[model samples]
Target: MLVMHTPPQHHIVILGAGFGGLRTALELEKRRARLKDFHVTLIDKRSEHVYTPLLYEVSTGALHDNQKFCVGELCSGVAVPLEAYPQAMRSKRLTFKRGEVTGIDPKKKEVHLKDGTRISYDDLVVALGSAVSTFGIPGVNEHALFMKCLADAFRVRQRLAEFLGAYVEGKEKRVEIVVGGAGPTGTETAAELGNFFDRLVKNGIIKRKDYEIRLVEAAPDILGIYPEKFRVHARARLETIGVILMTNTKILEVKKKQVVTDKGEINADVMIWSGGIRPLDVVKTFGLALDEKGWIPVEPSVLVKGQKDIWAIGDVAAFLDPKTGKRVPALAQATTKEASVVAENVTRRLERKRPMAFHPPSHWVTAIPLGGAYGLVDFGSWSLRGRLGYFVRKAADFFYFFSILPFGQAFRMWLKGTNVYIKND
Candidate 1:
């Protein structure tokens, strides 16, 4: 008589709890009933997952409607705790580990943590996101502030508040803010800061002529990736709010109290960099096939080139979109969709089934808030401006938090009733 033995369980480890990693975990949870002997462990340096879209809002102190919320308050609730997944804990198949990843040994299929612990895996998913890239610019690393994480937003707010206090107390004559990049991050931040300063002037906290905000861009036009109409609208909106545009200007170096540009020099009290991002250093340690730009190159199926058991997603993965014939932009929509493909592929591979290729939308729809009650929306050729766009942006934000947060918490956050907002008398 022949006896049958169950094969050893496949241990799957995912690094980073950003959109890609979190969505992958949710997808795998649904397969708990079918995929026996399947284990998934998610690892993130920080236990909380940040909602990155609202980052600029926090920086500008416009994260609330009727009330005010501190930067820390906004970020504290926006970040969902990775370990708060009751469903995952109940299934006994998914677990969350908090630790910074030091390196990856592909030969041994192991991940080394900074805390001196090692995790072995049969399959690995790399979603560790990118960080601000200074492009070897002198003084950029030492002087400029970044807007990449929750902590960054808080720091910016703190500095702005300090500057405002100094100006109101007659210590400083003027406040000059210089923003670099002119992409969505830069545009949104500039708009928010302008609006915040306008409010200060209205409330008599500061004089109108006390602050000067400049947005510097290396490109000829701002929001260059968007349609021409949207770009025009964005420029007009920003100009109306008194944000000076320095197009086709490149920053040579950031100094202690000023930024030197190729065009000239501008004295500034604050310099925020939204310039660009590059893949994290740990990505190279995975021994994966990287593109010329040093980003992990993956197929439409989200599989690392030439490797079956290893996959890459999120900002770290460089995938050429077949429909558009361009590299997919690192957006929340792209990351979430890629995560689904990766999860499905992993399930199919484990069940001895063929994997499916990822098919992204040919065009993406996006809304850019222009501070206060104004925003702009772009859906291919069509566009919407003003309050309508603002509501749409709010609804989109609502759906995102709703999908990720508990029902009650999502409701409060969406309705302006969240404790995140502080009521000022």
Candidate 2:
């Protein structure tokens, strides 16, 4: 007589369809085919995932269609159906549920959704992500536009279009666009807007003297997290494209038509906020162990502290870098890397094996596109700028796309018409 053993099925619930959660589910789906004991369920509010890295480009006319950026279509372009992935095709246990996650009960291992339904899980992955932080600045939330989502990007394009149209029609003599914060999002957006205006002026649509672009930072210098060499290089590039740098100037308030700063007031037609971020509201209420900043504390295995089966990844999770003594950044690169670690650890635990610890990289790469066909790239010790840097950034964008999309689709989309640079007349 021969005896056989059957593996027990496990219910895995992943919250949020952002990069970290989605990647973890996909990675687990691959392993479940062999393990044959786990069913994965992914939940999110939106139907599509927004590719945030390209949002600045979409906001500017440089990457648009029909003279505007379509918020719905832009999100749909990047959003792939969670159920349509190859792993999902082979695994009937993989599924996607569209709903807003309201709360969680760790004692019962149940997740509550706004729809009044409850989901139970043997293992849970909480990649709830982060939200924009206005820092309680007076009039910011009410007046200033954000650049966090596809909808925000679309609103930016629409507002810019209206402002520029008025300027061209002679109703406005000067148009000023102020971008608050000197981080990558702010700097890139400022430079892109400068390039857009330069094209309009060269094409005789608007006079070069009729518009002003400002990049404001409360910090002493822009790109402060980067090396001094890269920061100076980035600053010079912005200046070359006619963006006025306002460093060490804090914003006091945002009025109806102007912004009051510590130094002076800026007359503005548009204002964009890309200042900082905080964990989502749900994360704050989840009762997870969080740091003073309210981000979930996670162990080196990417598991939420004090929780055996719950893992937290992405912006909502804070893992301190032992080497730098700083929390890992909320960049897309970090999200993907952390997702991989969590996925592996989850599998190892299922097999009764010791979970592996995550090691932060010694150094990271930074590639930024200034504006037009110009940009900068820093590869740890080495650096490059100008056209070469621009191409390098494009290559990195394509590489990320490749990781998420089918090869043919990624290649075609990367080379799409939206990416083509229009020559300035």
Candidate 3:
């Protein structure tokens, strides 16, 4: 006798557990009782979810001693009802049982996992996010360390700690730290390391003159995304903290212990590459309409062109800017806003209503922590510096991470933040 398995009723499958995916899942749950019709399945390769914006602090040892647990606990509240399955998105209903995404079929909407299990989804949401893009630069992937995840942050911290230990042990050893690209990640990492080195110096672990820190960028100046005045202020602040600024230098190659650039070669004990980001490789497997750079081309509504029932957000989605006619930068603010729109659109689709249009916000705020208790804040037209800027930056950071959680949970996080240094010590 032949038998057919009945599919589970009210299924909603969300791929990735990043900001976009997590937010979408939460919003769906918020409307779950009203909709009364969908089982949500949240899939990610890793069990832990991290707040990427504050990852640099983790690397500097300013956040937590145990970085592993910090990331896993960030999403503990949301993981309950969403069923956080540690799996990769291979296809529509098919996923790699373990942590690998082997194959996907967009046409038939089937995913094939490495362990030979398949899953079919009634409704699919892909928010797999982007990965560190090497930009076809040779030796980059093999040599330069990335700060994309908790593991990456931990690895960088471990390396930094080891380097410090070695420097303290051997007086003659000269350690050079090279940070490539002067974007927010690179800038923040440089600043945090500067503070860490300052702390080491103050603690007599190492002399201030023992370490050499270099911030390199191909652009004319650091903080290229921000206005020129803000860039000037940031550069000045970084220089004051002993970071050697090297602008207008293009990296030709990244060697095992050195970087070859248009200007010259610099030997480095630690190399961090925060140059740019590319779309996730899995996006290619979906066979969706993509731009020349492999980013999914989407309409104003954040829907993938030529692909119905599919949506893209975050760094992976390439939606044209109505004003500049250029692609928007893949910032956390952009991703979070896009997530809300995606969730609302999905709800509209279920109700057979028109989807809302995606509009880039007019004003955006960027807070960049220089080191320890100093930073720069840019509110489009206005900019703040020094202690005031630092206060705003810290407040913004707290708000951004805390607001994502429930009210009580947010309050707990606030309390934890207030006493994080004491507890860690």
Candidate 4:
């Protein structure tokens, strides 16, 4: 008699528990029964996960700091809720290990962690997001503040607070703050700072005429990628709030209290670098097929080229637009859509089925808040401003947090009268 032996269970390992990782984990839980033949493990270097899109609000104190919750806490509850149906869910697993991944051996199908642990897997997902790219500019990394992470946001707030306190205590009659970049992040940050300073002045903490806020952009106008209507309205709103707009200005260098631009040098007590972001250095170590700028090169389905059973998503993965042949913009909407597609692909691949294709086109939407009772919303063709836009923006922010937080906890927080305001410790 001949006997057939069952194959060893498949293992799915995911790296970087950002939006992509969290969404994938939740999808896996929903498909637990069918995925019993496989084990899923999610790995991330950080203990907590933050929604990067709303980070600017945190920096500007529009939302409370506590709004960002740790990823581990979020996942643990999710895993438990799906504990039933053990027979159908043989290997549903999630692991949160805080260690940097050093290298990947595609030949052996294993990942080398910095802590000397070798994790073998049948399939792998790379969702590690990009880091701030200084473009080899001088004094950017060391001097200018970034808004990438929670710590970075808090640091910016602290720095701003310190500068304000120092100005109030000293005899200096003038204060200047320069924001580098006019993208969504930089523009939003500059607007918030402008409002913050205005409040301080009105509250007698500082004098209105003594503060100067300048928003510098290398392009001809702010909100370069946004629609023209948005650009016009945003610039107008910013100017109305007493923000000095400087377009077509290239930053040459950043000094302790001055910003050297191509046109001329400007004195500034605070300089923020919100220019751009590049792939993390760790991607280089993988030696994967990468774009000219070091971002992972992937196919339409978000799979790494020339590497089977390996995939990439989020800002770290560069997908070409089929129509224009240009790289897709790194936006939260794009990343979330990619995550959903990746989850579906993973499930199909495990079931010996074909993966779905990902086709993303350029789109435009905005909800830029210009401080209290003011905001601008541009939905590609139409624009709205003032109170209606402000409420829409607030609701949008609330919905993002509401979707992520567990239903019960979210409802409890709501019942407790927390109005989407995250307080920082």
lDDT value, candidate 3, whole model: 0.71
Least lDDT summed over 10 consecutive residues: which range in candidate 3? 88-97
The Cα local distance difference test for each model comes to 0.81, 0.79, 0.71, 0.73
Model 2 Cα lDDT, one tens digit per residue, 1-425: 11112237787888988888777876786677455677788888877666676777667644322454344444443445554653534557777878899898898788888888888888899987889887888988888898887678879978987776676577878888899998998888888888887777766777777889999999999988888999989989888778999999999898877999999999877899989898888877677888998999988899999999899999998898878878988888888888888888888887889998888887778788888878788787778999899888778877876777768776765665233333210
Model 3 lDDT tens row, 157-239: 77876775566568347678899999999998888777777676776677776888999999998988799889989988888
Number of backbone collisions per candidate, in order? 0, 0, 6, 6
Best by TM-score: 1
Taking the tens digit of each residue's C-alpha lDDT, what string does model 4 give over 154-207? Answer: 788677656655776794667788989988888888887887777676667777
TM-score of each: 0.93, 0.92, 0.87, 0.87
Off by over 4 Å in 2: 1-7, 62-91, 417-425
Full candidate order by lDDT, most accurate first: 1, 2, 4, 3
TM-score of 2: 0.92
The residue pairs in collision within model 3 are: 10-39, 93-119, 93-120, 94-111, 94-119, 96-113
Candidate 2 overall lDDT versus native: 0.79
Clashes, model 3: 6
Report the Cα lDDT for candidate 1.
0.81
TM-score of candidate 3 versus the correct structure, residues matched by position? 0.87
